[model samples]
Target: MNINIKKYLIITLLIFLIVNCTGNDSTYSVEVTNPLDSERIDEFVIINFDQLKITQAQQVNNLTVKNGETFIPSQLTDTDNDGTIDGVAVVLNFKPSESILLEINLNSPEKSKDDFIKRTYAEIAIKKSAEFKDGKYIGGNYENINNVKVPYNHIDHDNLFKYEGPGWESDKVGYRFYLDWRNAVDIFGKKTTDMVLQNVGVQALDQISEASYHSMSDWGADILKVGNSLGIGSVGMLDKGKVIMVSKTDSITCTVAENGIIKSDIRTRYYGWEVGNKKYNIQTDFSITAGSRLTFTEIQIDNEADNILTGIVKHENANLIKQESSIENDWSYLATFGEQTLFNDNLGMVIFYKNSELLEITEDEYSYIIVLKARNQKASYYFGAAWEKEKNGITGEKDFVSYLNETIQKLNNPIKLSYK
Candidate 1:
């Protein structure tokens, strides 16, 4: 009886060992490759023993591509040959709410064009609504960002010219129709500026965002208002007139017609400069000469601060005194054209412009007198009278000046052109 029992026990022990070895010998292999890398396939390989089963019932939290490395199921294996588990192989079994097949056509004649189109399409798909909600992809402001609908405001008109002669005459004229700030901020949020700055850098970002956010519909309404006032696009006699559309950036210029035709929109200047800060004092000898039929349609002032002068003073010409006065004081002259002011409380002229026809001259002789100035002010202060007090920094006068210059420049340039 004892021998028979030992034999049976030995057989059972052998069978258990065999089963354990078989289970340990089970192997699974997975190939890892970089989707972004165009050169090579099968970038790496990983193998797993003992065929670990992943819980398909659970949902995935998030997935992301990090640092040119990708994670695969087989890669999640114990490197140290110990009985303890080191990593896990995840198999997500939950049915996707929706599956989208992103088909890309790269049949472009040019390789560069084909690659660009393919990459852009891939980016759009990765950010698509379905993939975002499923948690298959991560990063980007997906949840917070959406197609927002808000009132649109665009550039009514932007006119720029090098003034010359005694009166204002056009040496060169450039205009831009752009999106308004209030409307743009309403639709795209204030972060739109940061978004654009990321793409185009600090210089062109604001202009591009302001221009692109506003559509042609906004442009049409604004143009109609201006045209109706001038009786150009009305139903009567002036319907068939020509409409001229123009836009000018610091570096380039563009123009188009009302019939969706592109006209003389070319890059005249290769380089451009932008105002750096709010308050500045730039002395440039610039001038504008206008003809007798010149009419000032609009005048926009960017800086509403009490003391800041945005005007023109000819070299050695002192008659133009664009002064500011305060109602609080005894009507004291706050700032003079050629002089500077210490604080923003002193009243000053911010901006001034008038629309006038060009004066016909024997020769194309003109000059411009440019003057830019700003004031320094206490932005914030504590009311306590004792020595121990608190103070905070406010928007600098130079910073205000910079914003004003940028805004005024946009107003002077329109993005679209039309024919009456």
Candidate 2:
């Protein structure tokens, strides 16, 4: 019958060329290594694409990033809030002590989400100004200006509740927390990315309660001189050796959980009392990564107190360099250098202390401390600043202690991630 129908059409074309040349992949493989020999790491490999189904809007072209070179997955949708989409962060740069093997070919067809909406870089703002004051009650108003309220004075001499003060940014930096009562922790020294922390906190609160507008230097001022010290990373309590200072936080809370293409987390919560008498509560999560100048602060503390203190706001004309890290997942830095910052220029402040629970780096007469041990009460720190006037930032203190020992070796050699 025609030679058995030509052998059944050559056995159905050899089973469709062995199922299209064996690429039946639902692929997944992620193994990156940079054990650090000469030091060169710039990582972030996050991948969660809905727990790795690889983005199914038609398989998003199989999401490939083999050999290395992928970024643009940080539009931050649902970030573990469960609803979905907090996948793919990939920024890999490793070398010096390199060990790389990145492949997420999935079954590639080729497509991309290219830098995903530019990742935003980071931002947040909470402004007010209808002009209320020690009378309290100044709810949250944005965009427009009602002279705002809820600013107890620096850390709160008293007035408690009505949380949500304001301040946030990240093209490199910006911060605020003086919403009254000496809660002190202020900074806002930018050059550009200019949103300028709520117009420099309404011109330093109209130059402090209408002294009639002026200072705050055009746009980027308050270069870091947190008097009464412990200004940069704020929070103290080591007792016996003295460092109490904890008030104005009977309650406070702010948010912007995440708003970026690469980074911005601004979460805050600080509830009443801490200074041996206990009953404390502080939760700060602030992250500002996109090329970092440093602002990672994790700090949990529910007051089990094993260790907790932070610093770097002392200035007898700056110059307080202490560094420890003999390896063992490295970390310990407490820097300060020249001109005592704050408009005087040259400012550089640091306080890393990651791991080993960091037990000491103390000093008194207003700041240089870093005694952190709290593991269950949680603790993590990093606060950095460098301003020769921004552009290229850290230009001294040996490049700000080699960018704080390359961020303590990328937080003790992290970026070894693995996935199937």
Candidate 3:
């Protein structure tokens, strides 16, 4: 054979082998069942990639999920930020006691980020070149940042973070917490059902002051006045007969774990948390899913014997309602509804937790709290809010109560995913 012809033939053979090996596609069969008799709307379905009976090795980023021929709102997540996708997350619905079979197809043509409608978002934005006063960032052009250690001098209203601190949201609602001594979570009552957190504080509005996010725009407003209380589900440690905030920490770092089209989360680590002369490390994982009003939390105090607590901020006219689930001791909720929002409109706040973890339900001057005997210093709970002005949302107290009850039922009876 001629030398050039032989070289071309060899190259063509290699290309053919590579295409045959890498271009093949595979589908994973999944059967998801809703155990409850009631219909569940937008139930969060999450499964680890390892659970899928995958026949061929595939890249997680190039995966897609479909119900049939239609694409579903889904994403691959590495919740721990270890650079490896460990799970598949999707939002789905189920009829009364229905079972769903879904296809998780691997090696599908990778979808563009814009191809998926963004139902969830999270961010930590900071100014890069403005000014620092008293060892704190004052003002500058804001930009998205991640995995940053919280400076010791950083304090409340320092303008270090746009809208106080890291914010996360779903299509239903939004949330933010002050990354300072306050450590109180606040709610953003959205008027529209669209994803609005991205343009909240940074985007210029036509009919408001400089900080239009605080004022109600076409999107929403800062609805919660946190003050010195646990505005929503802020974590605390009951020490020396007092529930102290995560204030006295040797060092703290905030990381945006997974900000996505389907889910988003923030991981905050408080190292060497000192309370009552007892030093204990603490970490918290806060996540939100698409089309849901709930923010799920996993708090770790690093001390097994310690009882961690969380609370809903107190409002003058708010009515606190406590309800237990019908399933003996599985799940329950503590909620409050009234004119609690900053707009003087109706708002509802809730905390859903397992009944077994309940240690005490008590109150302070600033908040209504629940103390849980955290197992292994680790506990999981959920916090949520609803605004009456929200588009086609819960309006009255009866509707709010009904919403809470349905949420409790869904939590008590989760869907069962049977892999085929």
Best by TM-score: 3
Any runs in candidate 1 off by more than 4 Å, and if so which?
Answer: 1-250, 254-273, 277-309, 320-323, 326-420
Query: Candidate 2 at 194: error in angstroms?
Result: 24
lDDT of each: 0.19, 0.60, 0.82
User: lDDT-based ranking, best first?
Assistant: 3, 2, 1
Across 1-420, the per-residue lDDT of candidate 3 in tens digits comes to 899999999999999988766655356778899998888888898877767754325655567787877788787776444446777888898899888888876657855557878888899887678667676565566788987898778877667777878999998889988888888898888877788877877732211245677778788889998888888999997876687988878898898888988899988988888788778888888899988999999877775546889999999989999985444758899999999887899989999988888887888899989888879768889999989887787878999999988998788778788776
State candidate 3's TM-score.
Answer: 0.90
lDDT of 1: 0.19
What is the clash count for each candidate, in the order shown?
52, 27, 0
Query: What does candidate 2's lDDT look like per residue over 250-288, in tens digits?
Result: 655555665554565656566775565566877666666
Candidate 1 or 2, higher TM-score? 2
Query: Model 2, 100: alpha-carbon shift in Å?
Result: 6.4
Question: 354, model 2: CA deviation in Å?
Answer: 6.6
State the local distance difference test value for candidate 3: 0.82
C-alpha root-mean-square deviation, each candidate: 28.0, 19.5, 3.4
- lDDT by residue (tens digit), candidate 1, 95-177: 22211111111111212211211100000001212222232222332221111121121122210110100011111111111
Q: Tell me which residue pairs clash in candidate 3.
A: none
Q: Mark the regions of model 3 whose C-alpha exceeds 4 Å error after superposition.
A: 1-26, 53-59, 79-84, 134-136, 203-211, 325-329
